[model samples]
Target: MNTLSSYKHDYGPLPSEVSSAIKPIYEELSKEELLERCAGGFTQNNTESLNQLIWKITSKILPAGSKIVEIAAFVAAGTFNEGVLDLLLFMHGMDLMLARNSHEYA
Candidate 1:
């Protein structure tokens, strides 16, 4: 999970222009907004970790032939289970291209 970053007040000051533009917006964010950003960051990290693990297992299982289809299957499963379309279309397209290339090469 992500945590809010804290800075010391005694740190050197930013340039005047950067301070003017950033300080107000930084101060205006509520505690809830900060927590929400942290939660989103944690979710993204977990998803990436899970993707890597799945990919490692898939690669081992199919050292030959097309791993693209296997990756697409995992992505589509994620979309069906979690309803996030994250990269599913791209994976599917790669699988199609791989199929086409294998057929052409043969």
Candidate 2:
């Protein structure tokens, strides 16, 4: 049986008021727009790694403004999408030079 059917079987039918409260939410979730939004499904692996990378770029212990956070996110995204070498090259193109020793790590 479906999950909703199983739930009803185990716990009896939802009260009219409870069902009414849930109906709109269920309807909205089942709609094409929401379904399309959910089509990609959920995965936290990449996001967690990217967040770690961002925090590494801009330390979590320090207070940062939105612009700093934004820059860190962009840098993290570039590093994640490309590699350190490419990110360094891109920064070079934009006239942002890394220290001579830092290039060795890349």
Number of the top TM-score candidate = 2
TM-score of every candidate: 0.26, 0.48
Q: For residues 1-106, write the lDDT of model 2, one tens digit per residue.
A: 5685465444638888998999899988788986777679753578899999998999678899999999889889989988787677767878986898768878
Tens digits of per-residue lDDT for model 1 on 8-81? 55675787799889877877765677778877556456567666655654655555456665765677556545
**Highest lDDT scorer:** 2
Cα RMSD of predicted structure 2: 7.1
Please report the TM-score between candidate 1 and the true structure.
Answer: 0.26
Query: Positional deviation of 8 in candidate 1, in angstroms?
Result: 13
Model 1 CA deviation exceeding 4 Å by range? 1-12, 30-106
Pairing residues by index, what is the TM-score of model 2? 0.48
